[model samples]
Target chain A: EDQVTQSPEALRLQEGESSSLNCSYTVSGLRGLFWYRQDPGKGPEFLFTLYSAGEEKEKERLKATLTKKESFLHITAPKPEDSATYLCAVSRGGRSNDYKLSFGAGTTVTVRA
Target chain B: GAGVSQSPRYKVAKRGQDVALRCDPISGHVSLFWYQQALGQGPEFLTYFQNEAQLDKSGLPSDRFFAERPEGSVSTLKIQRTQQEDSAVYLCASSFATGGNTIYFGEGSWLTVV
Candidate 1:
């Protein structure tokens, strides 16, 4: 079975503070790793997708990096608007389970001005 | 139209009643998905559709939970004899191609079974 685990269930940061969130997983064959941002009442918004170890993607203040065992979402000089729950999901390469994503219990971030 | 769209942003149902939720994927998106999210938790996969074909439904909690994408563009998820545990936000997502693509989600339908 594929399992995803995220660290630091919650985070609090001041404006301009930089930090990172972690997502570690164990899978038979890792097809992809995804990062999403979700607000209180809305669904998750896609952030980035990392396919292989050493892959990275960036957008605005967020950067996502992947390793064989884990992935990281780094927030640089975050503002209050950057506050949201960060979710990590994985898709495994298998005949029957490749279509669905396995998600981790997300990390809720709060940035205060 | 612009993104994945879901109907009935909020719903409250009594136990033993039935409810249905609808999802319209983005234009030209070939893959659609349904997920259930409990309070303060990440979304859990419920089912998947590829061009109207229900390819995977292994994550559905029970037989009472059913989903269909009849026309390959819009999908409906129905719950029969809803229980209190069924209370959660049901999210619909779509991707242009398949599993490896970025999936965009709609504002979920919040279902509260009491």
Candidate 2:
């Protein structure tokens, strides 16, 4: 079975403070790893997708890096508007399971002003 | 629409009732998905569709959960005999291509079963 676990269930960071959120996973075959931002009462907004070890992707103040068994979402100088729950999900490449995204419990981030 | 759109942003149902949620994916999107997000938890995949075909529904919790994308554009997820455990935000997402493409999500339909 594919499983994902995220660390720091809740985080509080002051404005301009940088931090990193961790996502650990165990999968049969890693097809893709995705990052998403979700606000209260809203669906997840796609952020980044990392496909291979050592692969990295960046968008504005957010950067995502992937390893063999884990992925990290690094936030740089986050602002209050960046406060939201961050989620990590994975897809299986092998044929055993269908195309379903297995998601982590998520890390709730709050950026203080 | 520019992004995936869902109807009934909020819903309240009593036990044993049935509810239907609608989803309109992005124009020309080839794939659609349904997910359930419980409070303080990440969204969990419920089902998938490739065009009009229901490909994978392994994640559905029970037989009462039914989903369909008849025309390859709009989809509906119907839950029968709702239970308190069924309360969650049902999210709908769509992608232009298959698994590798980015999946855009709607605001989601918050369902509360009493």
lDDT winner: 1
- Winning model by TM-score: 1
What is the C-alpha lDDT profile of model 1 across A30-54, one tens digit per residue? 9999999999999999989999999
Give the residue spans of candidate 2 off by over 4 A. Answer: A95-98
Candidate 2 global CA lDDT score: 0.92
Candidate 2, residues B4-69, lDDT tens digits: the string is 899999999999999999999999999899999999998888999989999889889999999998
lDDT of 2 by residue, A9-76 (tens): 99999999999999999988898999999998789999998989999999999999999999999999
State residue B32's C-alpha deviation in candidate 2, in Å. 0.7
The residue-level lDDT of candidate 2 at A32 comes to 90
**Candidate 1 deviant stretches above 4 angstroms:** none
Cα-based lDDT at residue A53, candidate 2: 100
RMSD (Å) of each candidate, 1 decimal: 1.0, 1.2
